[model samples]
Target: MPLYAPSPALRGRQLAADVGLLAWLVLWVVVARTVHGAVLALAGPGRAVEDLGASVAGSMSSAAQAAADVPVVGDELAAPFEALGSAGGSVGGAGQAAQDAVGTLATVLAVVLVVLPVGWLLLRWLPWRLGWVRDAGVARRLATADPALLAARALATAPLTRLAALPPGTAEAWRAGDPTATRALAAVELARLGLPADTLGRDERRLGLR
Candidate 1:
């Protein structure tokens, strides 16, 4: 048997739900991509960081070179001055590498923490919001149930707030543990589902309650 037989209205609702879900996914991904790009732009090879490193290194190299010119010690200081230039180059290279690492980490974090989680949560929850699958499943389960079983199931599963649409005292009576009130509430709801009262004893017999 097919898992569900959804009405045309239900199918239409499902289609709209699908379109909305797709739109949301695309919009979310685009926004995430834009934010990711912005983060990379700010962190990657930016002039501020690169220039800071280069400027510091150049200043150090120039100072060291100028200091190496004392007549008596000039030859003796040449090696130290050259070492300073090498250290300056190392510093510049290290700073650039650090910036690159930071940018790469930001990209990874954005995808892991933001993009993946949003996609997962939306995918998991959005389908349930489609009434066709959900209502069809509920309807199928209730189709073979007896009146009392239907009432019992409704009491267990239906939201209490939904009872407000029934006769005035329905919610109050059900909340007060009145079996009659519960059955009446179920009757109204099941009627809307096109089921007649006690149409089958399958559910009650299975539950061993009748």
Candidate 2:
């Protein structure tokens, strides 16, 4: 049920790691925003082109309207202006499409930049953190309910060097139901997990060793 190690040193390290992860995420988010802005800047030329096209279209449309009022050859003169205005409108449409494409590209790039690194880190980190929480919770419960189970787990999982640091024949003694050996082995496992000795309970006599 604990989110951190009972040991101050281990708990401090865990807290530091959590803080580092948060900082990393924030840093990448800022970077992504900056990149998005930079990429969006590429749309400036498209905006200029769209404005120029619109101006040309508007001018030609007005010219066409005026020329249609000419005395004799009005229709022939207005036809060319109308055609030029349609061409300008098409150019404006193309510019708008280019701006839309640039916007889409910028968004995609920014998302990929953040998602790849941050998501990769989260994928690696979240499972380990959650696994520790689950395992530590189980260990805490077993420490109270059946510390022998913890001792057995230590025998199976603890490094041989660590087991050797205990009294000679500690494993054999544990197999023989020696309460001291059981408590010692259990303590080894608890300490490995950064849990305190008292997690086995204040009264050693009440432990499941008997």
lDDT of 1 by residue, 3-62 (tens): 222345544555676677677677766776777777776655544556666776677677
Candidate 2 has what TM-score? 0.91
Model 2 lDDT-worst window of ten: 201-210
Q: List the residue pairs that clash in candidate 2.
A: none
Residue 148 CA displacement from its true place in model 2, Å? 1.3
Candidate 1 lDDT: 0.61
Local lDDT at 70 for model 1: 68
Least accurate stretch of 10 residues (summed lDDT) in model 1? Answer: 1-10
All candidates: TM-score: 0.48, 0.91
